[model samples]
Target: MWKHFKFDPNSVNFSCFTDEKFNKFDNLLRFEWEHAVSQDLFMFTIDYNAKQRILDDGDLNYIIGLNRDRQEKRRVPYLFEHVNIPFDNKKFHFNKIKDAEVLFSLDNEQQTDKHLIIINAAPIRPYHVLLVPYRELEQPQVIERNNLISIIFPDVANPMCLDSLCDLLLGQIIETKYVVTADCIVFGCEFVAASAHPYIVAGLNSLCAYASVNHLHLHGMYCPGRMFIQTLKCSVFHTKSNCYLLDSFQPQAFAFEVKHIDEFNKISQDVYKITNYLMLNNIAHNVAIVKGDSFSSADNVLRIFIWFRQSITNGEKFERCNFAFLELSGFMTMPDEKVYNTLTESEMCQHMNRLGLSVEEQERIKDDVKNLLDN
Candidate 1:
């Protein structure tokens, strides 16, 4: 599936510090980083000092620690791992099935509101729930304005809504006495499955997870996927022995495994940052950040997946067609690479500008995103 879309690994400039015949893990990471750099999809200046430290330690603990220090002092955005257990006997209580139905009914009723329904998802992860306006929105528009604002200006209203949803979901879980452990809040404009208004999940939280439902929503728990689980079982790195795992079966269709919960948290933070950057730069419509695994097993042949949204084509009766692809891995294929590569950044910018995102709008979105994460 990916063979048709495979890109030349040599397209990017990357230098690894090992002569010891590239191993499977090394190859996968190198391929991903190189591909990203080549396409100018992401850029970063690595600290030589930190690089030396990591090489000397030959482990992730010291490296991640150094990275954390850099983030605090230099404000460099990077991805890391995080893990959380959703069950708490004292903080949560089970309800009756009738209560669950009632809670669902209430959510259904709330769907009439604009802001509340836009989020389409609820958070069952304690105090967090996803919220959005009820109107149908484009992905870029949501990120540019709605998501950006929610993240940047996480004021009373945002948190209050999240709390309200959480309270409601908990009520439902209790009603069924379903031994619910955790929940996740997924907020999006169109759910792949629901393909309607945004929605939310109230069950188990899995990291690196993907859902077929398209309604805007959010997940409230941190659950790792099969790939992440496999990676952790073989990893030796530890920091406070806390691990954060994410598993995604879409895009590059892979999973992520990291040693610390903080790292995973960092990834979420980075996602916000990336979204903010796009909106601020007047480049929202044609942008995507997808992560997953490309390998069928954990045998050192994995692929680090990343996808960037390219263009929208009007096929048949105005049905929206989005162009996107996985990097480095030849697993999933697409037919639009040449056209994407031919487009200049300015041309891309113009296209986004046409989508109603202006410079001021971008700034607003950036501010909103910052607020969402800070709070």
Candidate 2:
């Protein structure tokens, strides 16, 4: 199914890194990513609410005001245009780049023309693949199926169209399947306008995570963290299709799911809609994406999850509170061991609560998203 997948860079095309020589190299990527799980970093089914299970380090401060991201602006404005975009070697634009190192982007001709892949310089997990679109200058506004934000993306066709050199990056999708679980996050339009290159980030690892880059990207990490231990599963928002909207059982996060690969692009639609909702209401927000289901498995279900956190107050933004994908989905990767080791599950949970969308706001967002899917 993957060998024939589509890679469309119109908005953001899906393309596999089709190199017979890299076949073995691709396996190496999986091996390194799986090492995190081999170390047992993934969280499986367990009760988080039970006092005995949550945490014991009550003496340590939860670091509710933890502002660890040095790469991002401290006082982030609600729109992408408001922040001061970073400057690169004066010869190049900050995020607007034609070619870059493979780690930063598909920085070469062979890689760009065929299997365009960019590895993260300092990735949250090994083998984090960002499906990049080369045409950053052609920012055409695509169909606005979303009621909220009018997201611009490459036009979508089937996932297996071969006309495009890079139809899909199987490494990203396969990596997700190998782990059985993966986590991801988002940086909506305003979240990182300084870096205009658009891409989707997916990895085969995770627990507590963060969006370290402002360049528009998607995240795919492994497993739900301690924070997503109790995700809300509501069917009221279910579409006629198998797709359903999953709000984090916890208070701070909201997510929607499409159950088939055919609807994978729809995940973008939901994200744009939700981001639009947040923007329209003057609420600053961040979005994230985690692989919905294992593509390699017999489940035959391709689940794609799009989650967003609503920071409705200036205080929340001023606090530099990052309620992006990883945090909302049940984990927050602390800046250092001092914060990570000292923070117990309970404290982390408390911090997650603080970063989430309020109950009423979540409901409103869900309603709007549901309307988009049902239609």
Worst lDDT window (10 residues) for model 2? 181-190
Among the numbered candidates, top lDDT falls to 2
Residue 151 of model 2 has an lDDT of 28
Q: What does the lDDT read for residue 158 in candidate 1?
A: 44
Which consecutive 10 residues in model 1 have the weakest lDDT in total?
189-198
What TM-score does candidate 1 get on C-alpha atoms? 0.23
Total clashes, candidate 2?
A: 41
Each model's total of backbone clashes:
82, 41
- Candidate 2 per-residue lDDT over residues 2-54, each given as its tens digit: 12122222323121111222222334334544553354333321122212122
TM-score of each: 0.23, 0.49
Model 2 ranges off by over 4 Å? 1-25, 28-100, 103-115, 138-215, 220-236, 241-245, 248-258, 266-271, 291-300, 312-322
